[model samples]
Target: MTSTAKTPLPPAACATALDPTAEPFYLQVLQALDAAGVPYVVGGAFALAGLTGVERPTKDLDLFVRRADFDRLDAVLGDAGLRSELTFPHWLGKVYKGAFFIDFIFASANGLNPVDDGWFERAGRATILGHPVRTMSAEDMLWSKAFIMERERYDGADVAHVLRGCGAALDWHHLMDRAGPHWRVLLSHLVLFGYVYPDERDRIPAWVMHELLRKLHDEMLAPPPASGRIQGTLLSREQYLADLRHGAGDARLKPAGTMSAEEIAAWTAAIGEPHEK
Candidate 1:
């Protein structure tokens, strides 16, 4: 069960823009979630804005709802005359209201991390769409954003800004645990963050740096994971299909996640690339 502290928004005010004068589509969805008692933590641009005060134009609202509550959200949105779909059963769903959409996220696209009860405990409250809503924690957001290094969309800068803006407020130890086996990704971002803002280098904890460096040193001396599969394809499905196809006969080749061959082929085709011959 999630928590809500803010009072309900008036139907008329639900449509109000972020300016609170004009109703926005995203708010309407938020209002519906409130009515249905669905526990959600707002993320993406809105959460980023609330957490870091760096606002950017967003195409849609991102709401992280627990997997169990998704059906509840689906029914609530339907009753509110909205259309929705579970685009990826493993990780995401979408609620459509006219031209606007809400990305209902349950887990990371890479299938590595999930939004569990711990996320709710760490969420911070903020006023979004004229209603108070839980915002994702900096640590959770950083973990979620770390793997979004697709060809067209890279969120490294966003990660750096969160590091810069949140500073000591971010939970370094939790983030390190969240990164887990993927600690190298975290180290790369930290290195870039130091490069992006030289003055803020000290903002990141010294032990975190030492720990990551230690992991790197240990990795350099150790053999790679037993699986001969080239996992780099996990970084970007579209960009790495060639690597996967070329190694099709190699026993070491394996998909990094749950993405099915059909799904991968469809995804590649959507980007206008021909299916592997």
Candidate 2:
């Protein structure tokens, strides 16, 4: 098998933080999707929090769907008056609606998209803005984050936060097995993020994270070949750091806009209850 070299983290990742408005938008999207009965699981940064417990606000909503349901998704969003900008069948697999964008991902871009199998099986339920929804399992979120680390795209903090939040709850064996050949890269990311301090490295349980790192170091010295085309959206370490610095105080970080009295009254007459207040 051809092995791919990992790219070093870019400087911009620490510079461009996600807009603080992303959280409310996320809630809005979830409500809209749930109301429409569209099956989706939150992924990417927002989903990462469910796994790692890192609480940085995300810039966009990342939702994954079965390939068979793509057309249905298109129809649903179209009816909602949301426009889509398709970016796949080329490099980046993405779909955008106004200020919101969702990355269309298959399970394995190189082989088969194994996204649907057991997707809900690995999800846990949570309430967002009084709406009930299912999210990715903490372990699965870690697996997804670990895979991203292999590509050398984002900061170790993302992974660090995951480790801190769900380390005790993670299934080390399952995580190792799912990480496949890219285990060491993930471990190095954890170390870089200060999640695994040098002095405390030995103390990390001999379970999944530690063993996976050790095995990858001893066995897979040659890395996997980069599969998907590298998207420019990948953030560098510097950008990630910068974002962390400024993201906390972003002005857009506030409660979502409440509907005006007229709008609320119209919605109450139309939907029979107050949807937004």
* Candidate 2 deviation (Cα RMSD): 16.1
Q: Candidate 1 — what's its lDDT? A: 0.72
Candidate number with greatest TM-score: 1
TM agreement with the true structure for every prediction: 0.83, 0.57
lDDT of 1 by residue, 1-277 (tens): 3322232111111121243322366778888888878999988877777666667666666788888888888899888888988876656788876556678888876455778998899998877645898888888888888877787778898788788777577778788888877898899999999899786677777888999999999999998777656556545656666766776322212355555655455444656332111
Positional deviation of 10 in candidate 2, in angstroms?
31
